[model samples]
Target: MSTETVNPVTGKIDEQALVTKANRQDLRFAIIGFVVLVVVMATLFALVLDFMIDGVPRISGEFLTNYPSRRPEQAGILSAWVGTTLVMSATAMLAIPIGVAAGVYLEEYAPKNWLTDIIEINVTNLAGVPSIIYGLLALGLFVQIFRLGQTILVAGMTLALLILPIIIVATREALRSIPLETREAAFGLGADKWQAVWMYLLPAGRPGILTGVIVGMSRAIGETAPIITIGALTFIAFLPPAPLQDTFPFVNFDWLNSPYTVMPIQMFNWISRPQAGFHVAAAATGVILLSMTLLMNGLAIYIRYRIRRSSR
Candidate 1:
């Protein structure tokens, strides 16, 4: 099926000209896309290289275990890392179930009416709202109104709010990706909506849902503004009380009430210092942060892969 036709006036087919014109357009777009990709990769490579060169040698066992100090040589990220883990753990626990449930309700159970439409629109809009705004809101509501203070709990709750819309959107998308026939088949088998969703649609869509969770968590983990607005200390010197102390019950909710700091805040504090040693330490902290983020993403990918395989 040739697209070309003879130019009757020239008494010859213009097939070669047409093909060349089409190929030229395709090649132009391809080259542009490739150049953009190369530029992005190059930029990322340069940043990673800088971190390695200026950061890696500074990383050591002492850096991992010791607390922050006024002296650059003595400062470590012990409290920062601990706070990050605790806050992220709390954030995930609070956000995932609530966010996913909201998404499922909106996507699967809610009527296609004006109220649902408005709610959906707001959720979508919130996803794009500046992170700083979430910080401000958390400062007012979580820190002041709730009287949570500058604890890991407050920071976690604030971050949970910040990433909630993202998780909801992601869950809705994942639910939507499930085939309509699957639902229909479940109904035909005498299953209720809840059963269909729980037994069939949820498992089918778990991978996409997990992907969204990972993205939301990643965003939450890296955020500084919200935590800072809630007055998260930048120079925390001690770990929050352990979740499992030697108390009778063997569990401590009091850890949530303690002061906290995170990797990003710590890195920011270091980078702002006048000392070159602090600068190097900042880069090393960046390396650790980057590594943790990558590890989280990789684990999510592996989990997604496993879920997909199991479903098959």
Candidate 2:
């Protein structure tokens, strides 16, 4: 009787080669599945794009950067441009430090306990909740509880909360990716635990943190529902004032506290109009938004690559 032998180098048995051949054949079916997915996504995009509408050229120079006009045909999203910049600036201000710090604590300092478990669970779950619910929470808590009013400040804080969980999770993953040997080496070098994490873990995780914040900010930029709920005025003709603070001496809160609008809200305002021109403007607005999101993603990728290269 002849027995089949397993090749240790390739980890293939005589009979297993036959199974591998069948698996290779199965990959062709997966390619079909992927092609189907791409086609479906493209079809959906065509249906939703403002540019896809027949014969409407709404993207004029004025439309790209002009103030809102009483005439829907003449309205541009300039104020919304200011609003979005302000909102994102504010969201980044609040979200990055708080989220990343919390993540660092959990990853480096937190003990494995039921309390931490519950926190981790809640943070994960919070990320999945509808943006509208977060908006409602902002309306009730930030606006109502502290009476911040429906201004940009209130909306910014609310959005900060919405993205906080995401940043924290990303930070943890980045921190976790640092090898245990690195931590032990730091310990061996007579560095304290905090110092070890701050010096090595943070640098290693910096890329992930940057990427996470950019991704979070990308979503935050497009969030109209939450800001709308918090009273981001649909149309404003004025550029928001530069930030000024009497106490801070040079910081202006107008950049932070004024009635603001962002690109998404402005696009939404245009899309809702009865005018056909405004619909075209909405598509143009989407193009602008897509550009910004892509830019942010690119920046994040660049930062990650640079850091990884330096570390290597």
Candidate 3:
């Protein structure tokens, strides 16, 4: 038990004694929080280590380069990885500019009205919506109405929809973190709202924005349900057409309309097979998927660090 003391000289509560008691409480809480963090980290590390142990030996050049096959020994992730790369590229190209622009408009330009409030609330709520829901929606809209088919474009659009809310929220939060004084100073210098946001606020908040983009993409990469729901093939042996051509107007858009499968879908297909070798292949795919996610996050962190260092 702890006791509070009164200062005999001033007939007041002892500030130093109160501070000591508060510090003790804070220290106890801190220790508890640290213990919880360690437990979570250790658990995650163990799971990842198990995957690595099962999968690392199976990873090889041929495993990466060959297409999926009925024979587990011959099966590889070439088409899946290539499709994933193309889809992610399309998703990033579509989502970033649109999400960022919507965020900036909502934060800096939108009036504080009921309609804006509803939109904001909806955007926030959409972030928690299941990926499968987006898939169903995309199937109805993009696939049926737009006749996009179960192609890379439709897949990218679906994932883009899934991650848009995340990027918007991140962008708004990043912009909001800029100091009021900074905004005032920009205004005082005769800079317009657009100039202030484009020049100062964006550069200042880029690290946070990039972090959010990385997080959203990481989530998108391992998503299987949506991709499956959108009719991604379980066993695709063919690659998308090359984006570059030898003829005039060399950049081709044919690949966007090509049937595709992502890493998660490929892994799912492998896991569903009864063969133990396929299970091993699934574990290896998980390892590769995890590695790709980590590499993306690492690259984002490096870029953020560089941005901060340059700004300083």
Clashing pairs in 3: none
Per-prediction backbone clash count? 0, 7, 0
lDDT of 3 by residue, 184-225 (tens): 989999999999999888888888788889988988898888
Query: Of the pair 1 and 3, which is ahead by lDDT?
Result: 3
Top model number, lDDT: 3
Q: Tell me the TM-score of model 2.
A: 0.82
How far out, in Å, is residue 268 in model 1?
0.5
How many backbone clashes are present in model 1?
Answer: 0
- As for candidate 2, its clashing pairs are 83-261, 84-262, 243-252, 244-251, 244-252, 244-253, 245-251
Q: State the lDDT of candidate 1 residue by residue for 1-312, as single tens digits.
A: 353555657868788877787898899999999999999999989998999999999999999998998999989999988989999999999999999999999999999899998998999899899999989998888877988788888888889988899889888888987879999999999999999999999888888888879978988878887777788888887778789978699998888888999999999989999999999889999999887777778887787678667758
lDDT of 2 by residue, 225-311 (tens): 887777778768787677764575787665665777788887888778888777767777877787787788789888778867876
lDDT of model 2, residue 18? 58
Please state every model's RMSD to the true fold in angstroms: 3.9, 6.7, 4.9
Q: Which candidate, 1 or 3, has the higher TM-score?
A: 1
TM-score result, candidate 1: 0.87
Q: How many angstroms is residue 286 displaced in model 2 relative to the true structure, after the best TM-score fit?
A: 1.2
